[model samples]
Target chain A: AQSVAQPEDQVNVAEGNPLTVKCTYSVSGNPYLFWYVQYPNRGLQFLLKYITGDNLVKGSYGFEAEFNKSQTSFHLKKPSALVSDSALYFCAVKEGGNNRKLIWGLGTSLAVNP
Target chain B: EPEVTQTPSHQVTQMGQEVILRCVPISNHLYFYWYRQILGQKVEFLVSFYNNEISEKSEIFDDQFSVERPDGSNFTLKIRSTKLEDSAMYFCASSGRTSGNTIYFGEGSWLTVV
Candidate 1:
């Protein structure tokens, strides 16, 4: 079955340090990958998505993700972490074509300490 | 920027009672979706609505669940009889005319069943 995996349950980083949240996906066709973030008591917020073009896709809040087809990975990354970035991050994917439902990864809790 | 909107940011109900969650998708979006996240769990798709009908649904979207676009602006999800297991954060989302567009989500409605 098509699925997404966020291998890390939690990632910790010092403020201003680079941070990464790993994600890998398996699907039958071209994958449309996405990243979302949820702050406590708030709804999931769209971060970035990879549809076709450049492997490096930039999103809201200084976040970006690299889509690596060979590795079947689309990892979320930020050049510099902020305490405000501490939250739960999710990776989701849907196969290209008419598929409407998104296969989601168990979220990764990111804590950027000051 | 336009965004989806949901009502009753939080609701508490007794088991076996019916509950309706309301949403207002982005004005121009043609595709609507409902998803849920059990506390600390991966987001799960429940159903997708398009052209005034359900286009897709997950196994979790059983007979107990129903969706309607009840007019031009409001989309709703009705649970015929709520269960304790139904306690979750229900998100309402929408996308552009085509499936390739990004789905934007609303601040979810939290349902607490007792």
Candidate 2:
């Protein structure tokens, strides 16, 4: 089975400061991890994904995530935060192959304050 | 960038009424999926379709739920008889090939059962 855990229900950050939303996963084989953001009343927007190659994967809107195999973690990070970046963040994982479906985490609410 | 699109941004129906939610996936994508998020809950997978057939589905996708690719460009999810608990935001997603690919999500259709 594959699953992801977003330990924090909410994360607060000040504008211009770095932000981190933790995510950890469990999978039978190699994991394909993803980060998506959802603004109010909108659908989830893909942020980034970790498939293979480098440990650090950069994505849209200046966000990135580090895939740590040892820790079974794929934590989303932003070098600097913006008030507009505040949204609901979700972490999802899949055991790569014909699975076709992702195991999702309970979203973490991010609030960036100016 | 092309995107997946969903119809009926919002809908309200009485309990036990049948509801059909529609989606048009990215033209070039080969895999399609449906997921739902009840308020404050995780985004749960409903089903995945490829080659006009369901490749996978979650436990939440019970007998009450059925999916159809009625045409080359459209995918629909039908709820046989909606319950109050079925109220949720339904998201349609599509990917280029497999689970490892980055999937794009539609804005979602919000369903309210009375």
Candidate 1: residue pairs that collide: none
- Model 1 misplacement above 4 A: none
* Candidate with best lDDT: 1
Worst 10 residues of 2 chain A by lDDT: A94-103
lDDT for each residue of candidate 2 in A39-103, tens digit (9 for 90 to 100): 99999999999999999999999999999999999999999999999999999998887677888
Separate DockQ for every predicted complex:
0.84, 0.89
lDDT of 1 by residue, A12-47 (tens): 999999999999999999999999999998888899
Question: Candidate 1, A8: how far from true, in Å?
Answer: 0.4
| RMSD (CA, Å), each prediction | 0.7, 0.9
Deviation in angstroms for A86 in model 2?
0.5
lDDT of 2 by residue, B1-114 (tens): 898899999999999999999999999999989999999888999999888888888889999999998888999999999999999999999998755789899999999999
Candidate 2 wrong stretches, greater than 4 Å: none
> Candidate 2 at B97: error in angstroms?
1.7
